[model samples]
Target: MSMDPKILAFDVFGTVVDWHGSIAAEAKRLSLPVDPNEFAAAWRNGYKPAMAKVRSGTLPWTKIDDLHRMILDDILKTFNITSLSESQIHELNLVWHRLNPWLDTVEGLTKLKSKFTIVTLSNGNLGLLADMAKNAGLPWDLILSAEVFRHYKPDPETYLGVAEIFNVLPEQVMLVAAHKDDLLSANACGLQTAFIERPLEFGPNFSRQDLHREEFTTYHAKDLMDLAAQLNCK
Candidate 1:
């Protein structure tokens, strides 16, 4: 909070979209013979490890779309699902492109837009984020991704890249995310932080007892609307 950042970089996936609900609905729509909730959880469970490989330089930099597909292939085998045609599988893989925004997202972003510049800093590819923004009506001034930096979140490059994009000091860029580690990484690079409480990011049945603000984040809010209100957005 040292400087008023003109650009607000958002963490997508759980921060902006209901990925759990969206994946579950897609699973149901495909008539996959697995519990939608379990399938959704299983799919998400692979995300961190997938990115870890890239972070550790064990795997080349890849977009979240490819990472999701790799996980999907593994999950399909794990669940003994072999009935899906190639086209069906490919179409299903695009669920990320059609994720649903949280109920307050569009309205909150619209309000915030009047005061500040907004952009995504997601691990998802630009095409993926663009499609999701369009499909979900997210009002972003720009769409940035790991594809641009070739590094995933928690990487200093990705955090600082947002600042570089707007030709501002890192302290002049704020990262808004639901995950602490992400905000911490941004903070380490001299960026301000805002923690968003996305209780059901994983799934509704899962317990998210830790929703309190941490010392690392500059601001914490119940959702985007609350954040906008705190920032005095009109």
Candidate 2:
């Protein structure tokens, strides 16, 4: 153990849980006419651009729940899904709050929790992350979000804020995420970075070819369990 980092902040969504899988499953269960995979992809595709509007001040700061609803509305329109009632659509929008964790999530997080403080550093709003953690039985020491910092991932404020919240140096906090962009931002903020690969994050059909060895990451692992083993968390 390095004994340098007292805190390990995680990125949720694809990092902690399988968002695409969960959404697709929910869509399938709802008997949507469209392919579940395509629906999931279409919904997620709207996320970044939606967040970009907030990041660039093109739109006012918005919570992820609202952004997700916005995207869901767009996808429903695109798919010509008008059969479902408004209440059903609203419930569908909350599927993100009940996403399933990766198979190794609980065990790996439990192992790491024994060694260091584990918290969420996701762009998700507080309610979404809290509901997901509770629903998935994720063992988190704390739940921090863009809602807490009023800033999203890839933003220096969000990364450095973790250290600030814990009264530690930037290097004393490590960011564990599946996205290179997220890890890169934390690296720029002087935090240690770990890349946890979620190759199937997008879905089985969509392969993420961008999972390359990167100089920015302090550690690279296949999943949360691999990360725990590499860190000697046990």
Candidate 3:
């Protein structure tokens, strides 16, 4: 396991921020007809497929904000709710930019930032991530995204792009994420991997089954704070 990675690239959704809880709360606040939890899940479920279209060349290179809007439109129809105006729909879509951070996120990232060059490696667009970091007080040296690379996670270009941006070898960078698929892809690209567990990432109704430590990852942490501790961060 490489303990001395030069750059720590983090996945924002479900790792630094509580996407499920945040989305559900916002949905409840908006008085949407569907169950808030289910709405959040449904919205998120559309993410991969929408991105797949871009990845497969079926769609042009679309930013996450645009993709999210497309998904939200479909979800609205599926939920059979017609109360929202266009402005309201746009504001609701911005919930992703206003997501709440996990309780330990700020403290953990602060600690790690003191020790390493910390940045984001999320599928979230640059503007979205910037707004989230501003809203949540996340301390980051940089906010790198799929938007910058024009490719999403699990794509080697996205992972290797971090290394290229920092002029470091892939092994000198570590991918810290809550998803195994992301870590696996980064590992395949010769980047070190750290898995952060977020069991409630899908909300209270669904428990994640893949939180176990795996051989592919150099570190397995319960949260960002745990990851900070493991890395001997102050």
Mark the regions of model 1 whose C-alpha exceeds 4 Å error after superposition. none
Q: Give the Cα-based TM-score of candidate 2 against the true structure.
A: 0.98
For 109-215, candidate 1 gives per-residue lDDT tens digits of: 89888899999999999999999999999989999998899898888999899888899988888999988888988989989999999999988799887789898
Better of 1 and 2 by TM-score: 2
Using lDDT as the measure, the top candidate is 3
How many clashes in each candidate? 0, 0, 0
lDDT of 3 by residue, 1-234 (tens): 565999999999998899999999998999888899999999999999999999999999999999999999999999998999999999999999999999999999999999999999999999999999999999899999998998988899999999999999999999999999999999999999999999889999896889899999999999998999999998
Residue 152's lDDT in candidate 2: 74
Provide TM-scores for the models. Answer: 0.97, 0.98, 0.99
> How big is the RMSD of model 2?
1.1
RMSD of each: 1.1, 1.1, 0.7
Lowest lDDT block of 10, candidate 1: 1-10
**What is the alpha-carbon lDDT of model 1 when measured against the actual structure?**
0.91
Q: Write the per-residue lDDT of candidate 2 for residues 99-140, one digit (tens) a residue.
A: 999999999999999899999999999999999999999999
